[model samples]
Target: MDCGIILPSVSPNSNYFSVHASPRSPCIMVRCQQKEGQVKNNHHYNELPLLKRKRPTMINIPVDRSLENNNIMNTSRVRVQEVEVEEDGYGVYSKKGISRTRLEDRYSANFASDAHGKSKQALFGIFDGHGGAKAAEFAAAKLGNIILDYLRRGDKSMIEENIKNGYLAADEEFLKGNATGGVCCVTALVQHGSLIVSNVGDCRAVISKAGVAEPLTNDHNPSREDEKLRIESKGGYVDCCNGVWRIQGSLAVSRAIGDQHLKQWVTAEPDTQILTIKPDFQFLILASDGLWNKVSNQEAVDVIQPFFTAGSNKPELKNACRKLVELSISRGSNDDTSVMVVQLDKFAH
Candidate 1:
């Protein structure tokens, strides 16, 4: 991945700052110094201060900006896209928080099938990373496949058990990577007119029923009574850091995919729920805590409801996703935000 950073000149002779991404890691390193023999060329050079005399050239890395197919449109800060699925119409939008330079949130949406490609299943998920983005990236790339693999190789009759095991399997696989930090997740699986929703940590899934907003997954925060008890049972304590409660006064959520340091208290087993698609069910929203920290479940649905009132098309869904991200940022949420909208009507039997 290519990232850009701008640095200010510190001395009168300093001409520019050379910035490049580190090959060993994701960090961007900058070398700021005076260009030995460069002459000032701008007419206003004499009037401007050393810092303003010469500006560092910025390199813009263009991401997918197309509206057709499944490509994502990425600006310097935001990325929006329509998922390339044959049946469900869903859109994804994400923005890096103002507090951070790199975006840590990751998402996944696709269809899975058995060996013969007969049983098609839809999966959608959002992952919010803390400390680093590795955990989120790993989970986003692997979780869906792991779950689908269970259904393919294992007993399909015990769907809930299989899903729960699938989560544990993914968590175990992530731990083996020896990566730092962790990620919160929320996923939606659709098959046979059933919407199976699961979550670990604070990422959430909300559904629009008729015109009302209903939450499907409960956020797994230490503030919850059961979560608090579970943490304490593992000999971990929860403390109020500022206004938010955190597990062992370090992590905010009680469950996650990585965080090997706190694996004792931070479990990865998700809470899963299965809902039969009804006529009233309109659409589903999956987002990270960044959006929830500012927008309420009802408010989110209210904002998106208008976009789908006419019809759930790709462009309209993209607009709805963009609006939700913009709304969260406008409300002073500086955390990385990711929002996905899945039209449930198309999946209804």
Candidate 2:
């Protein structure tokens, strides 16, 4: 338990100093002479005292090597695995009535060190799926790897290209497996105080800076004029069959991955943007439409502000995701809910 460096030294002619002994304790005390740099242990001497009359100085004492190693191992083993999930029918049907599934998949990686040995880089992502979990799982497993690989390849402008390529690749893989689900994806890579974000579908990415929520990616929906124009221009029309424009009356989102039917008319090219993380940039929020459908970006940021500002004890990011999902359910959002909150300071090495 006493795992530390202790220095013990005595003069050639020292008076008798009593040392205490514990019952059957496994303790080793190493004594070293400053001039000789030699080490020795006195098994019989339970306590070694330092006298003011001694001219010899002990630079360092070797404590229990095993104890010190154990302490270091324990410290290095500390890590955080933050994740959560929830699902509810909300007075709709029987046990098999609503097949509502909430999938929250996230990935966060930070460089242990930088090239100049001063700054570090961090990467994060959140994938929220609606129709099925395959898309979300796919994005969670592969997007971060793709982005990191691109960065490692030393392509300065490859972030956006890599994101677009990753989305398209996931779409292809999903279609090959006969999975018909669609997902809203968002990714952020932070390097050298800059952030590059890419998003598709309704899952949103919002940056909270200076107490204001600024959206990083626009929602690709039928209601947006830009999306509407893009969809219509590609020979696609958004028809309001159930009070909302649906692609060909089947898909709700005008843009998404793995919607083969929709993909025929609409592609999965994500909207990408690069941002600078100034002192004002506090955090970023990424979540599926389930959270955004019931809560605005500003409202969601407000709901999770306390967690981010209250230091590092709480699992703010995961808790924020859970809270957002709970709020969506309370607000009668039947769709699956997922949220991801990332703090800039947490990634600042």
Candidate 3:
């Protein structure tokens, strides 16, 4: 699985700040040193869609720790549905959840290549759509491109600033139709042996380094103390329904890309995390709430690590992804689910 790039996997320096946690909610928040009476809205956050009470009950699914030591061939319950993926220094896979009739989840993988077909840079993401799929569908196709355009400017100083602008631009562009619905997003960008992760809402990103799960994004649920305070400060209220805290008694997440009607409270700005790919950074798991709600971070990592470590040839990330989706379904994930497994060929060497 060597792609000619190997990096250190731990001791990451945290440089990511979001409008959501700060002023709060995005790779999109822009803080300013303003005087009294002046406010800056650099964070391109928006309110969420107000609908009937929607809370997916969180179910604790116990992981069989012994499964981690077994070979993939021995795992009879898991099937190998390996998609014929075009490899450019990475292996990837994703699937729709078992609960939804109309799959609203969407994702994308973009690799910047040279003439010989080797990849120099890559971007991957997972988007969980609620209300409808249009917003999720739109962001999957556009966010990466927007960021790439910014990088082409050759201004490392503005990399973060530009990426934030990209989210804002995407949000602005989508709102042109005054469209309905919202999407939670988690994205990873790999370049110069560094991984930049940005997220909004409950969709998450986690990297398994040295066989340990290191979380890269925060789940922006209304129940989180920080989130509750932010919403309250805005004169909004958080209430528990069916055992889940929701903003304004309707939306479950505090930040998202759309939800035009709830813009005042729910934001689109994503929190960001930057990590230099370490030697032990094996792979990354990016998924929607359905998977996260059902699978604990360590459980998810422990399940997949054995596959990469024991296999003779490179472990198929697609198979690992499929097994994870299956795990979530078996664990009672009652919403649309999506997962992407990224084999960090560069780091695993």
Of candidate 3, the 10-residue stretch with the lowest lDDT total is: 67-76
Could you give candidate 2's per-residue lDDT for residues 41-159 as a string of tens digits? 33334434432222333232211122110110111122212234211100000000023422233333334356776547655666665565566666666556665665666467666
The CA lDDT of each predicted structure is 0.78, 0.59, 0.70
Model 3: how far residue 124 lies from native, Å: 0.4
Instruction: Spell out the clash pairs found in candidate 1.
Output: none
Runs of candidate 3 with Cα error greater than 4 angstroms are 1-95, 114-117, 346-349
lDDT of 3 by residue, 1-349 (tens): 2222212121123222222222222222233233333223323323321222224444322121121111111111232222223243344344445454455776777667769866677878788888877788778778778777777874786666767777777777777868899889888888878888988899999889889998999999998999999999998999999998888888999988888888889887778887888878888988888889999999889888887889544776666777787898888877766667787765322
> Between which residue pairs do clashes occur in model 2?
19-47
Ranking by TM-score: 1, 3, 2
On residues 71-162, what C-alpha lDDT tens digit does candidate 1 reach at each position?
22222243322222222377777777878766777777757556986545688889898987778878877888898888778887788888
Best by lDDT: 1
TM-score of each: 0.76, 0.65, 0.72
